[model samples]
Target: MNESNRKRGVLSPCAACKLLRRRCAQDCVFAPYFPAEEPHKFANIHRVFGASNVSKMLQELPEHQREDAVSSMVYEANARVRDPVYGCVGAISSLQQQIDLLQTQLALAQAEVVHLRVRQNASYSSSNSHGGFYAASPSNSGSPPTTLPASSRGKAIYNMDMVFDQANMGYPIW
Candidate 1:
């Protein structure tokens, strides 16, 4: 008896064949993508999509496109195992939600930075016109005296409390 023929049946089967408990032929379509080392991968796929269906899918596709088709099927099958109800759609929806949340946070942070820069510029301008900027609070004593240096006499004097009105701000960041 030839040694090749004797040992051929004992050759280590591909992951797909092992999980399906079937003979793995020399030209098995799943040999490349579904190596025997990682049985769990094919097991997960088989659990979701039966071995017969996978074989039919592989047989239907052209030889050149079989590898990509198997990869996509495995990925989708794994995802389906993780999320039974929505499968890959659930993962896609989750990722999209996270992206939207991150974008909103980024927008709010940018708005805050712009607001701070404007406030800083205003304070710097106020100080440059006079020796320093003074803050006034509306107290029971009386309305604070509205006086300005000769250089800023015609310029409008801004009140911090009034300037921080929520409606005046471009976006409601909070």
Candidate 2:
């Protein structure tokens, strides 16, 4: 056959060329292959494709293929959301565990501090008083006893509370 008779590309009906007083050079191989029973042009292929119409095309797909596509899309989206949620929960749990551990350590240190203060007070009272339980009473030495006054004691306790509170409210290690 001559070059003019030889088809350049796959043949499909060109309606525009048909209306414009020109040959409707059929192209797009699959077009002719499509069964007449199937709907044609799917939302006027001439115009821009719309999301809603594309969705309708998906809906028209075979049941199994449509189900698989929908299920896969849903699963992928759910996985995207679920992975982050699970990670956040795990991170929060780890942070809480760290906080608990730090709180326990602070309590132990506070107890140790109290124990040391009590020991210091006992040693001073014993040394300052002549067997009297009170550090205020005068001893045979006649020197004014070294003792933490009530105001100083209150201040010390207040300082300890502030220190431990600050420690307990510390940021998570991780």
Candidate 3:
């Protein structure tokens, strides 16, 4: 027993040793990573990877790397338990899809803002040219304008309402 174990009176076996129904030696490989207080941590790992495999893996690794390896094993084991077939990969894929959807929505909103700005500029220019009063152009008599001027079109402005309608149709343009 080490100083800490000896000071605590009767030595408490580590989780791995307790689960395996064996004594925990002073130099137990699992003692540092799987303390007695956190039995579930080791339980999940043990359920996924057998006790012998964990011990052999820990023994093969350097002391500094053992802790990280144990942590990774515990995470993978828990993920495996939660999702038997796809595990962590499924969680990662779901998050990536959400990110892609959010990005598309953001791009669509940005395009809409640019389109509105172009329409506002066109409206202002027409009003200025016609004695500071709004005048309905002959191309859009008694109806709202649907297209920007040729100069504004060169600035990459498009019909935002049409773009949004297309997005609702299940096909999103890049």
Best by TM-score: 3
> Considering only N, C-alpha and C atoms within 3 Å, which residue pairs clash in candidate 2?
11-26, 11-27, 12-26, 12-27
Error in Å for residue 114 of model 3: 1.5
- List runs of model 2 lying over 4 Å from the truth: 1-85, 131-150, 153-174
Of the pair 1 and 3, which is ahead by lDDT?
A: 3
Candidate 3 lDDT, 33-78, residue by residue in tens: 9888889999989988899999999999999999999999998899
In the range 28-126, model 1's lDDT, one tens digit per residue, is 877767878788878877888888888889989998898888888888998998899999999999999999879766655665775555454455555
Of models 2 and 3, which has the larger TM-score? Answer: 3
Worst 10 residues of 1 by lDDT: 136-145
Q: List model 2 lDDT by residue over 27-89, tens digit each.
A: 422232222233233223212333344356556777557555544443443443545455445
Give the per-residue Cα lDDT of candidate 2 at 88.
Answer: 44
Higher-TM-score candidate among 1 and 2?
A: 1
TM per candidate comes to 0.69, 0.32, 0.74
Candidate 1 regions exceeding 4 Å error are: 1-10, 131-174
Evaluate all candidate structures by whole-model CA lDDT and list the values in order: 0.69, 0.46, 0.77
lDDT of 2: 0.46
Between 1 and 2, whose lDDT is larger?
Answer: 1
Specify the poorest-scoring 10-residue window by lDDT in model 3.
Answer: 139-148
Tell me the deviation in Å of residue 26 in model 1.
Answer: 2.3
